[model samples]
Target: MIKFAFLIALVAVAVPSPAAAQGASGFSVVNQTGLNMTNLTIRRFGTQGWKALGNAPSPGGRGSVQFSDPDCAFDIQATLEGVGTVVWNGVNLCEVKTVILNRNASGAIWVDYE
Candidate 1:
């Protein structure tokens, strides 16, 4: 009985969950700026409404957002505390695993994808 139970547990651990199988459709965000990201939203390119991804990954933290659209292009919006709102247009989530928020030397916000 003990060996049977251990086999079942090992099998369960080896099998991927549904969400993990679908991870190709989703992406992660890495916040590298000094300010806290208060709000994060995403929308399909050329769409009118924004879908909230989630709340603050405080400075230097990271978060993940799952999207359901079959389209690969999207626009991302972020609200940084004390810094107002910033948007990155026409990002291809299908090609990237992580979107990194960064600040340039000129004090402008920029993005990097990995």
Candidate 2:
């Protein structure tokens, strides 16, 4: 009967907690600029702190980054060579706007804040 008890304990411990069931969200970015760009960096702002989710060279000329936070409360920052943009998920920000890209060129980055 000891083996049966041990199996029951193991199964209980193996279950995932509610808090640990969080997942990442996927987002996309499009470069509307006629010129091709490179060196794309993505950032996610959280209660803990801001962190870089991922970075890659824009193969599509346009850049795309996914936010990997299930409970995302993040802004996005995209940097290409010497230009960058900061985006939030809201209409009204303290000083920064959500859809504003620092670069004068044309391009759009899509973000899904879960």
Candidate maximizing lDDT: 1
lDDT of 1 by residue, 35-103 (tens): 778778888889989989887578889887766666667888888777788887887776578888886
Off by over 4 Å in 2: 1-24, 33-48, 57-67, 84-114
Candidate lDDT scores, in order, read 0.78, 0.43
Per-residue lDDT of 1-114 in model 2, one digit per residue for the tens? 999999999998999776555643454444433334444443345343445635543433433444444443455444455444434332122222122223344544443211
RMSD list, candidates in order: 9.8, 10.4
**Model 1 TM-score, 2 decimals:** 0.70
For residue 91, model 2's alpha carbon misses the true position, in angstroms, by 9.4
Q: Return the TM-score for each candidate structure.
A: 0.70, 0.35
In model 1, the runs with Cα more than 4 Å from the true position are 1-24
lDDT at residue 36 of model 2 (Cα atoms): 40
Distance from true position, residue 71, model 1, in Å?
A: 1.2
